[model samples]
Target: MVLGSAVPRRRLLLVALLAAVVLVVAGGVVATRLVGGPRTDRGATPVLTPGPSTPASPSTTPSPPPPPPGADITGPLNLLLVGVDTRVSVPGWEPHADAVLVLHVPRGLGRAYLFSLPRDLVVDIPAFPKAGYRGGRTKLTHAMSYGSRVPGRPKQPDTAQGYELLRSTVSGYTGLRIDAGAVLTFNGFDRLVDSLGGVDIYVDQRVVSRHRQPDGRHRASAPGGYTGPQMVYEKGRRHLTGWQALDYARQRYIPGGDYSRQRHQQQLIRALARKILDQGLARDPDQVQQVVDALGDTLVYAGGGRRLVEFAYALGGLPADRFVLVGLPGSSVGSGGSYRGEQLTTVGRRFLTELRAGRADAYLTKHPTLKVKT
Candidate 1:
C-alpha cells in the first residue's frame, strides 16, 4: 500500500525510513513505536544497558557507504532483534524469546548479516539481582520469562525487565556488545501487518499451526495442548493477511521445528520490508504522515544509545539485496531426545567466533551451509 503524498520530501523520507529500519530486523515488521509515544503501543521498549564489552576484534566493518546527506552513525553496528511469543490470549502465559536474532551491519554498512539464535539452546543464565532469583541452566527462551518476574510480586510479568536479562544472556553468549535492542510482541506484529495491508511470504515447507484453527480463531485448549482443525500452509508463495502471516511463522511442530520456524520468521521479516520498499513511500511525501500515523501505536523501538529516528536516517540507505540471512541450528543431536534445551552446533559456535573477529564474511563463504537460502 502506498502512502499519501503532500508532506515535504524530508518528512516523507523520515517516516518511510521507520518502516525500512524496523522491518530490516529479525521479524521484519517488529520493533518499537518508531518515535516517542506512550507505552500503550503494546510494543515493548527495552533500554540497552552497557551490556557487554565489545570484543577486541579488528575494526574492519566497512563504513556502510555514506547514507543520505544527514546520516551520522556508522561502523560495525550490532543490534539484538527479539520477537517475543506473548500469548496474551491466555491469562497467565509469560512471554518467551520466540525469535532471537543478531543483526550485524559490517563496517561498510553496504551489507548486513542477520544471525538467528535458537530459542531452546541451553545456556547458563546469570543471576539478575532485580528478579531476586539465582540463575540456572535452562532453555535460552526462559531468560525472558525469568527476567520479567516482578521483584516482590513473582506473579506479575514485566517485559522490560525480562528484556534486560535476555539482553544480558544474549550478549554473554555471542560475546558482542549490543549497540541497541528491540522486543516486539506477536500481537503487535499482527497489527503491523494489518497496518501495511497484509504481507506476502513464500512458504518453504508445509506447516500445520498448533495454535490457530482454520477459521483463524484459536483452537480449543486441552490438557495436552490445543486440539481441533489446524490451519495449514502449503508450500509456495502466498499473499497473507495478518493472522495468516503470523500463524505461518509461529509454527514449530514441523520437520525443522523452531529452527525451521526461524527461517520462516526471517523470511516474513524480509517480505514485510519488501512490501514497504515496493510501495516507493521513500520517494513520495503526500500520505507519508498517514502511514506513520497508522504505525504510530504499533511499534516501540528503543535505541541502545541513539534515538530511534537517528537510526532511521543511518539505515535509510541499506540496499534490499544487502540483507543476508544466516540460520544456525540450535541443536546438533538432541531433537529426537527429551528436551532439556538446545545447544548450538560446533559450526554455529565457530561462526560466532569468526563474527567477533570480523571474519564473518569469510567464515560464511567457507561454510555455505550456514547461509539459509531465501
Candidate 2:
C-alpha cells in the first residue's frame, strides 16, 4: 500500500506542484473491460482466447524501461483504482465504495500523480431502461449502481455487469481512457492484510470502532454491551490484525468525515506498503501461499491474468522513493444526501485543466526527487 501511496507523493514528490493525483481502489468481486466494452462475468472461466497477445514466461523477464520522457505529453494517462464495497444488508449500499482513487501516472517529464475523487461528488447518471434512469447527475459512485443493466440491455442479475457500468461511467466522466483496473472485496483486503502480517498506521485522533463476531459489523464505541460497537484499538503507531486493520481503513464516521477519512486511508496504505516490502512478503513462499488462499475467488483484475501479471511486474521493482501521492483539490463535494449514494463532486476545473494541458511536466521537471520520511 505504501508503494501505492507514492501515487499521492507525485504531487510534491514531483517538486511541490502537486494537488490531486489519485490511485483508484474498488473492493468488489467484479471484473471490467479492456480499453472499451463491458465487463466479463465473474463465474465465467477464463479461456485461452486467441488474439494478438504477449506470453509471459519465467525465462523472459520484464526489461527495465527508461523513465517516461517528459516532453511527450498528450491525453491524460488516468488509472481508476476503485475499492468496491459489496457489503449488502446495509440499506441503499449500491453506490457505496470502500476506497476510490484516480491515478495519473505521467509518461514523461513529471512524476506519477494521484487524485482522490470523493465518492460523494454528485454527477449525472446516463440513461438506463429498467433503471428508468436517464441523464441526471448524481454522485459519481451511484453510476456503478446501474452497472448490471446498461441503458438498453437486459438485467442479467450479475454483479460483474454492474462493475462494467462503473468502469464505463468513470471513463466517460474524466474523458480519460482507463488503461487498467482491479477489483477486490473486503475478504480479499483482509487476506492481503493478514498475508502481510499487518501494517503500521499513525492514529492522530482517538476514534474507537466496535462490532460483533461472526459478522464483522462496525459500530461506535460505547460501554459494556452484548451486541454493540466494540472498541477495536487506541490511537498511535501500532500493528493491526487483518480484521482490525480493515476496520481502521473502513471507518467512515470520523469527526472530519470522508475527507479526513480519505487522508488517513492513504496514510495506512503507505505504511502497509512499506511493511510489505520490508518483510519481503513476496519472497516468502509460505506467506505468499497464505495470501493467495485468502485472496482466492476474491481477486479480480480487468485486462485478464497476463495483463495483471505484467502490471504487477512493472510495479514490482520500483524503489520506495519512486512513489508519490496526491489528492484532488477543491471544496467539499456533497454525499448526494444518502449514506450509500455516490460522491458527485467535480475536481477543481483549473487543476484538471492544467493536467490536460501537460503542466504537470514542468511541475515534475522542477521537482524530480524529494525526501520521504519514515
Candidate 3:
C-alpha cells in the first residue's frame, strides 16, 4: 500500500513538471481568449476594456514594452467569466451556472491571473431586477435564475446586466473593475476541453456520481441512463477528459465543499494556462485553429480579434514565475438561509478596498507564497 501510494505521488509530480511543456504549445489558443473574443464573422461583440496604456507592473518587473506609438494607457483589467451548464435537453435550465471565475490581468503583468469564486457565496445580488420585489440581496447564482425568465429582446436580468451588477457588487466588495466578460455553456466547455485534449488535475479522494433528470429541453442522456458518477481518485495527478474533467473541477459537495471546488477550478485554469504557454502554439497555426474550432457555438466573446491577439502576444512575453493567483478574502460566514438553508459567506470589505486601489501587490508582497489547494 505504501509503495502504491508513493507511485501515484511520483506520477503526479512528473505531470506537474510537464506542465510547462504543455503551456508553450497551447499558449496561442488559450492566450487569445485571455483578452480577445472569437472570429468577427461569428457575430461576437467586441470587448471594450481599455488596452494596456502604461505597464502597471512597475514593481515586479520593468513595464512591458510600451504599447505601439499611439498605444492607449489602460490600467489593470478584470474579467468575470462564467460557465453555465445549459444543454438543449435541459431547457428552463434555471440556474445556468456551473462555475464562476474572476480573471485579473494587470497592465504589464503580462500573464493572465484567475480566481474562482464559490457560487455558494451568499451575498447581495445588487441591481438584481427583483431588487424592488425581493430585497435583491440573495445567493449570487440566482442572478441567472432571475434573468433567464425575464421577457424581451433585452433580457431583463440577462447575463450582461447580471454581470454588470455582479461586477459592481464584487468591485464594491473587492475594489476592482471588471472590464470585459464571456460566457460558455456546458456544451461549449466540453468541446473546449476536448479540443485542448483535456486538462490534468490532482484528485485527493473518492467521488460517486448521482443521476440528475435532464430538464427535457436540453440534450438527452445516453440510453444507459445519464447518471453522473461521483469521481473518486487517489491523491495524485492524472489527465481528465470532458465530463470527467468537468465534474472533477466542479465537485462542490466534497468534504471541503465549495471552497475545495473553487480551488480546484483555479488550479485547472492555471494548469491550462501554463500548458498553453509551454506548448508553443504560436508556431502551430493548425493546432491553434483546431482549438478555436472546438469553441464553436459555445463561445460568446465580448470583443474583436486583433486587440485580443495583441494582448495574447503580450501575455506570452511574460515569465511564468511572476504570475500569481489569489482569492477573495474571508471564508464561510453566516448560516441558515433559503435554498436548503444554505449558509452564506462574504470576503472582507477592507481587503477588497485595498485591491481596488491597485495595490493587490501589496497584500501579495506581504504573503509572497500563498498556495491554494483544492
Candidate 4:
C-alpha cells in the first residue's frame, strides 16, 4: 500500500540532510552524543555486512533507474541503530547498546518506520565466532559489550565487531534481516545537534537532570546518588543546546521511565528534522558539506556494501513527515522485587510480523495506538 503523499522537492532533500547532517540509525533518531569518540582507526573501513541475502539479479546492460512510487521495491531494508554507552573511545572501552532502534524502510523507499527495543530487554544473545562470545540471556544492552571484546587484547574491545554481533542478535530476535547499521557513541549525538546550532523541541515533560548541575557542570557524587542542584528542562517549546538535548534524551527516571526516555528521543529527531528546515541547512551546500565532513567524527556506519552517502541519497525521497515513530508495548520481566529485563508482548510481536510481511501501513492503520504521537 502507498504510504507518504507527494513530498515537496525541497523537503525531500532536507530529509536526506536529516540522514546525512544529523544521525539516523534507522529508528526515528537516537539519543546522546552517541558515546564512542573519534577512532584511531578512522581511515579503516568498518566491516559492515548484511544477512538473509537478497535475490541476485543478472547484470543489466544498462543500470535501471530507481523504482518509482508504488513500484516493486527490492528491500524491506532493516537498519539497526545502536547508541553506545561509553565514556571512552572504541577498543579501549567495553560498551553496551544503550539505546537500540531498528528502522524498517521498505524496498519501495517511499517511507520508513522507526521502532525501539528497550535496552533492558532480556534475550539470549547467540554465539559470536568473531569476538569468541558464547552468549547468554541478559539485557539487550550487553550484547554490544559482549560482541565488542577484543579476543587477543582483553582491555581493548572492537566496537565495530560489537555492532557485527549485536546485529546478529537483533536480526534473530526481530526476524528482520539487518541491511545497514550504525554504532553511535553518546558523544556523537550532541555534536550533531550543536552543529545545527541547536534544535527547537517541545519538551512534553519536566526533566530534572540527574547528571548535570545547575551551572552545566557534572554533579558531584554523594552517598545515595549525585549531589548539587540539578539542571532542569521545563515543559514547553524551547531551543535545546546539544548538552541539554542529550541530557533530556538520556533521562529515564521520569514517570514513564525508560519508555518516556524513548518517546523524548523520538521527539528529538523530529525536532531535528524541523530544525534543519527552519535553519536552512538543507539548502546551503557549503554548510551541508561541513556537516558531511563533521559527520564522520560523530558516528561510524556500516552500509552493508554501499557508502553512507549513497544510502542517504537513495532514501532522499523520504520527507521528514514520513518518518513514523512506532511504539511497541511490553512490561518488565522479573520476580516480585528484582527486575530481570523486558520481553515484547504479543501485540509487539505482531507488529514485527506485519513489518516483515510488508504490511506496516495497514497494520499501523488498524492500531493507531502503536504509533508514537508526533
Candidate 5:
C-alpha cells in the first residue's frame, strides 16, 4: 500500500511541474510578442532593407578590410544617428540633416562612443541620378538636399532616397560600413524629450539666443509672424523642458558658433542617456512600453523594431557613464573674404586611428579637451 501511494504522489508532482513549465513558456512568448514582435504599419517604422549581398566562396579568406579613417575596429556595429530638419513651407525643399553622429557600440557591448561629424565639412558627393546636380565637392549637408529631388523631375520629396545617398556618402567619407542607421526629425526629438519628463544638463556658460529678437520673434521669422516665446538659459546645471532643450542645442550665435552647438547637442545626448538609465526605464515594463511607443512616433531605424529592441537590450548591461562623447578634431578654412569649410586636422586622423584600434579612452587621455561631458 505504501509503495502504491508513493507512486501516485510522484505522478502528481510530475503533472504539476509540466503545468508550471507550460505557463513559463507561455509567458515568455507573450513578453516577446509584446516587446520584440514583427513590425506593423502603426508600430513598426519602415525598415530600409540593405542593398544586394555578395556571396563569397568557401575557400576565400574571411578577413575584414583595413579599418577606414574614423571607423570602429573593435566591433561589427557602426550606426549613424541623423537629425533632420524638414522644412514645410518650401514646396520642393528636401529635409537636411542638421546633425550627424556616429555611434560605435563595440562587440563586447561594455561601452559606447559617439563621434560627431560637422555639417559644414566639405566632402565629395557622387552624382545622384534623381537630382540633376552632377554632384562634385560640396558641403556635407548638401548631400541630403541633392539626393531629395530627381533632376528634371516634378517636385516630389524622396526622403528614403536621400537617406540612402547620404548613407553612401558618409560611408565613403568615414571608411566605415554603416551597418544600421536611425533618423530622428526635429519634431520627434522635441517630443521624445518631453516624454522623458525633460533632461538635466550642465550649461557651461550663459547662452543668449541669437535666433531670437527682443520683439519676441525669431530672427529668421517674418516681421509680423510669431515664432513662439524666446528663451534664455542661465549657466550651470538646470532641468530643461523639451522646447528649452531644443533651443539650447540650436544656439549657433554663441562664442563657438556651430561647433559650440555641436557640443551642446552631444551634451543633450549624454543627459538623455543618463536620465533614462537613472529613472529605471529599462527595468520597468510600463516605462519601456511608453518609451517604445514614443520612439515609434519619431524614430525610424533600418533594422525595424526587432533590431531596435535587441540593441536596447544589449546596452542594458552598460552603466550611464560608459557612454563617451568625442568631437572630431578640425578647424575652419576659407578663401577670399567669404567663410570656407572645415577640415580635419592631423590630430583628427590620429584620433580616428586610436578609435579604430578601440583605444579612444587612451586618445582622450592625450587630448582632454576633446572629451565632452554633460
Candidate 6:
C-alpha cells in the first residue's frame, strides 16, 4: 500500500515537472514580446550603438577595440540578458546590473543552457567616451553604470550606450561573441509574472529578506512597534504572486548568499515560462499581446522586436529537460580583503573554453553536479 501511494505521488510530480518545462519554453518565447511590437518585415531589428563622442583616456586606460565585422550567427547563439534594478529614467541615478545571464541556444535549438554571472565578479571595464572615464577593474555589475555615466552632459539615462559598453565588457571576459542582448527592469519582470497570474516554483530552502529598514537597522524581529523584514518564502512548493515572486527572487540572505539568489532567479524564469505555457498564452494572440503590453517600455533589446519574436518562436518547442542551468564557478573574497570580490575558479575557465567551442554538453557530462533541475 505504501509503495503504491509513493508511485502515484511520484508520477504526479513527474507530470507537473513536464508541464513546467513546456510552460518555460512557451514563456521564453512570450518573454521576447517585451522587446517590441508585432513582427513585421518592414525593417531589421534595431541594433544598439555607442554614443558619438569618445571619452578622454588616461595612460592606464586602454580604448576598446572596434567589434569584429558582423558575422552571420551560425551554430549556437549567445545572448546577454541583464536585469537592472530600475528603469533608467530615475534622475541622476545610475542603475547597476543586478543580474547577468548568458543564454546559450544550441545550433539545432534542441537544448538551451543558462549560465549566471554573479554581480560581484571582478572584471575589467573599458573606458566610456561620454563619461571621460578611464577603465579599471571593478565589480561586474558596475560595467553598466560606468558605461551609462556621462560627465558634463545631461544627467538623463542613456541605456543604449550603457548596454553597448556592457556587451563589450562581457565579450572581453567570456571570449564569446554576443549576438544580441536584453535589458530587463525588475519592475517589468514583476508585472510579467502578474500577467501570468503568478507562478508556481519549488523553493529549495527558506528565504529571508536582507533589505534594511530606513533607520539602517536589520529588521530581524517585531519589537517596539517594529514588524521587521518578512520571511519572504519558506522551503517547499509556492504559488507566488508578482510582488512575492520578485521579493523571493531578490533575497540573498540565505546560506549561499548571491549564489542562492542566482539560482532562485533562474528558477523564477523557468517557473514563469511554465506558467505561460500552462495558461496557453502561445495559442491566444490576445493573451500574448497582453503580456507584451504589461512589459510596457521597460524591456530594451539589441535586436529589434521582430528578431526576438522570431528567436523565441523557433525555440518554443524545446522540452524542459533540454534546459540546463549552471553558475560561473567562483568563490567570494572576504570583506576585509584588499578587494571584496569573486574570482572565477579553474573549472570556470574550462567551462568557458568548452562553451566557446560549443561543447557545453561535454562539460555538463563531466560535471553533472552543476546541472540545475527546473
What is the C-alpha local distance difference test score of each model? 0.69, 0.47, 0.47, 0.68, 0.60, 0.61
True-structure RMSD for candidate 1? 10.0
Which runs in model 3 stand beyond 4 Å of their true positions? 1-74, 87-91, 128-135, 152-164, 188-191, 204-230, 280-300, 303-306, 328-350, 365-370
Shift of residue 160 alpha carbon in model 4, Å = 1.0
**lDDT tens digits by residue: candidate 2, 100-204:** 666565553134455566777665556655455565676666666665544444433334555555666666666666765544355445555555455666776
TM-score-better candidate, 2 vs 6: 6
Query: Over the stretch 196-276, how does candidate 3's per-residue lDDT look in tens digits?
Result: 677786665654333221221223367764444333544687776655665566566666766666666676666666655
> Which candidate tops lDDT?
1
lDDT (tens digit, per residue) of candidate 5 on 136-231: 887788787788776555577656567667777888887776765655455434444565567788998789875555443556665764354556
Best by TM-score: 1
What TM-score would you give candidate 6 relative to the actual structure? 0.71
Runs in model 6 deviating more than 4 A are 1-75, 87-92, 211-229, 277-301, 304-306, 334-336
Put down candidate 4 lDDT per residue, 1-374, tens digits, no spaces: 22133544344344434544333533223332322223333454432223454565676364444432222224557777777777774555788787888878777666778889999988889988778888798888888889888878898777777877788888889998777666765544555566666778888889998999767788998899898899999988888877888888889998888888888887776667555544433333333333344455454544433444445434544566778888888888987898898888888889999998888889999989999875
The all-Cα superposition gives candidate 6 an RMSD in Å to the true structure of 15.6
Scanning candidate 1 in windows of ten residues, the lowest lDDT window is: 33-42
Full-model lDDT, candidate 2: 0.47
Error of 3 at 164 (Å): 4.1
For model 5, the superposed segments whose C-alpha errors exceed 4 Å read: 1-75, 130-133, 151-154, 211-220, 223-230, 279-300, 304-306
lDDT of 1 by residue, 306-334 (tens): 44544544554567677788888556435
TM-scores of all predicted structures? 0.77, 0.62, 0.63, 0.76, 0.71, 0.71
lDDT of 6 at 317: 47
How much is the lDDT of residue 306 in candidate 6? 34
Query: Where does model 2 exceed 4 Å of error?
Result: 1-77, 89-95, 108-111, 128-133, 150-157, 210-229, 232-234, 277-301, 304-306, 329-347, 361-374
Ranked by lDDT, top first:
1, 4, 6, 5, 3, 2
Between prediction 3 and prediction 6, the one with superior TM-score is: 6
Let me know the TM-score candidate 3 reaches against the reference structure.
Answer: 0.63
